[model samples]
Target: MTVALMWEARASDGRGEELLAWARAQEFPREPLRRETLRAPGDRVLVITWWDAPYDAELPELPEPDGELLTRAVHRWRFESVGDG
Candidate 1:
């Protein structure tokens, strides 16, 4: 199975760039099959990592950033790949 973990955060006022830099700099103990990082309006950042493991597997995830950098707690979700079109 394939699993994808999503981590999203909203940075504090005017700190979007700093938050993006911080997220991009993070390193996992083991790399995932694929990873992507994105930024959006309203100072939001999104990171999605794909892993070649069972849906119930315990996998590495990105931790929260320093409280001072964000406006609210990070949000995360996990999904298993269903099928391709």
Candidate 2:
């Protein structure tokens, strides 16, 4: 089975670059099979990591950034791969 974890956050004011740098600097206990970091308008950053584990298996995830770094709590989600589509 394959599991994908999604973590999204919105940075405060004009701190998008800072938030992106912070997210990229984070070190996981173990690296994921695949990892992607993305940013969008409104100073939002998103990270998705793919793993070779079951949907319910324990996995590494990005921790919430410090309160002053974000406008609100981070959002996360987990999904089991269905198909290439």
Best-fitting candidate, scored by lDDT: 1
In candidate 1, position 59 carries an lDDT of: 97
**True-vs-predicted CA distance for residue 3, candidate 1, Å:** 0.2
**Tens-digit lDDT track of model 2 for 1-85:** 8899999999999999999999999989998999999999999999999999989999989999876999999999999999986
Model 1 lDDT tens row, 1-85: 9999999999999999999999999999999999999999999999999999999999999999866999999999999999898
Q: For each candidate, how many residue pairs have backbone atoms clashing (under 3 Å)?
A: 0, 0
What range of 10 consecutive residues in model 2 has the weakest lDDT sum?
Answer: 60-69
Output the TM-score of candidate 1.
0.97
Best by TM-score: 1
**Residue 39 C-alpha lDDT in model 1:** 97
Show where candidate 1 strays beyond 4 Å.
none
lDDT of 2 at 54: 86
